[model samples]
Target: MQPEIQLSNSTTQLESTQNKVLRNTYMMLGLTMIPTVIGAYMGLNINFAFMAQHPILSLLGMLAVMFGMFMGIAANRNNALGVVLLLGVTFLLGLMLGPILQAALHFNNGAQLIGMAAGGTGAIFLTLSTIATVTKKDFSFLGKFLMVGLVMLILASLANAFFQVPVASLAISAIAIMLFAGYLLYDVSQIVHGGETNYVMATLAIYLDIYNIFVNLLNLLMALSGDRD
Candidate 1:
């Protein structure tokens, strides 16, 4: 009886610790958006002509920088520095949004499209996360598929950068939305199911999922519904 009681207490403590980590992750995720929004607002004013003139080079450069940050975050994942690096990454990504966001605003109903994309992304994030929670299924299974889709996404995006095909661009954006939606499920499920124990890393994963969803959803809406004026 005494051993059983101790085992139960140990299980309860482990659960309590996990809940604390989850809560901290959510808090950090919320904090990250402030810097991201600020960076995006600043990005809106900057000239993106350089990107247009040097599209391929710019894309590769951005990828390199992103990879560096990923490594930095991974190295520091268990520390406060990881949170700092993650926020820095989000800010840089927000700045990168300048080009697309600027393009969206050129359309007649651009503002509406942006709002719709944001709303849709939010809806997906919430719905998928809720499902993961209620079902409590281990979504680590999705990691391999998501990684493959990510590789394909990068290749397609790089190709479209040069080819500039409208149909292909739209298709890529659509695929991206689905891929990141899968990531959202996989990420949130990881947090709930103990596959990921680090809140900092969890927040980073979920944030990227939402970011890609918003960007691609906005692109798709612009393609399908934009009033060219």
Candidate 2:
């Protein structure tokens, strides 16, 4: 009887912790979109011709900044400072979207494609998150496989950056869409199953998943159906 009672109490505590983490993560995630939208809007108005001309340098610079912010956020994950750093990183990511957004907006149906991509990303996130929450399955098992895929995807992306092959770009975009969709499930499951106790860190992981999914989805859509002026 004593052992059973202890087990029940342990389960209850874990559930409570998971609930709190999920709630805070969601609130922070919602807050993050505000800064992202503002930055993206600003990015749209800015001229990124230099980045367009010097793609590799631009990519390296963005990666370096993102790495720095990631380190900052990781170092501060226990306090509100993490939240601030996460928002800063998101804003910078939004600004980095300028070149791609500018390119997309040049197409006749660019706005529609962007909207579709956003809708698709939302749908995927909603479905995966719902599944993870409702089923409460342990998705931590996915971590290793997903990391391997991510590393490979990064290598392919870097290679294609210099090769500038249209087919390789399309393939990379397709693979990225699949990989980050997997991340959506893995990330949300981590939150629900007590694998991730810090909501701030959880929000950052999930945000990256959604961000990558949206960007790659938009790229694929544009490649498939972009209308030229």
Candidate 3:
């Protein structure tokens, strides 16, 4: 009976910690959007002609910057600096959306499509996160599968960058939407299952999932339903 009581108490404490992490992750996730919106607005007004002129160099540079920031965030995950770095990376990502957002806004119903994409992304996140939290199922099994799919997707995207095939681009976006949705489930489940104990890191993972989903979903929507003016 003593051992049983001890195990029960430990389980309760673990659950409490998990719940706190999940709650903090969600709160920080919400806070991240403010900087993202500001960055996007700035991006809209800025000129990216240099990027258009030197596409490959621009892509590589952006990737390098993002990778560096990711490392910084990970290294600082145990402190407030981690949260700051996370927000900084998110703002950079938002600024990087300039080209796509500009393209989407070129269509006759661009604003409407953007709204739909945002709404859909929000809905997907809410549903998947709710399922993960409520079910309390360990989705760690998805880790490997998602990583494989992501690698394949990246390879395909890089290949398409050279080929410049519109259909292939659309296909990549579609696949990306599914892949990141899975990531959202896996990420949120990790928080719920105590697999991710740090709210900063957990928020970063979930934020990236949501960000990718929105970007890909918006790409698909702009491709499929955009009415050029």
Using Cα atoms with residue i matched to residue i, what is each candidate's TM-score against the true structure?
Answer: 0.94, 0.97, 0.98
Q: Can you write out model 3's per-residue Cα lDDT over 165-216, one digit (the tens) per residue? A: 9999999999999999999999999989888999998988998998898999
Badly placed stretches (over 4 Å) of model 1 are none
lDDT-better candidate, 1 vs 2:
2
lDDT of 1 by residue, 94-152 (tens): 89889888999999998899899989998998899888878878788989999999999
Question: Against the hidden true structure, what lDDT does model 3 obtain?
Answer: 0.91
Task: Pick out the ten consecutive residues of candidate 2 with the lowest summed lDDT.
Answer: 94-103
**Maximum-TM-score candidate:** 3
Which residue runs of candidate 3 sit more than 4 Å off their true CA positions?
none
TM-score of 3: 0.98
Residue-wise lDDT of candidate 2 within 1-229, one digit each (tens)? 9999999999999999999999999999999998888889999999888887988898899899899899999899998899899999889888877767888899999999889999999999999999999998988899999999999999999899899999899999999988998999999999998888998899999999999999999899889999996
**Candidate 3 Cα RMSD (Å):** 0.9
Question: How much is the lDDT of residue 157 in candidate 1?
Answer: 93
Q: Kindly report which residue stretches of model 2 are placed more than 4 angstroms away from their true locations once superposed.
A: none
List RMSD in Å for every model shown.
1.5, 1.0, 0.9
Candidate 1: RMSD to truth: 1.5
Give the least accurate 10-residue stretch of model 1, judged by summed lDDT: 14-23
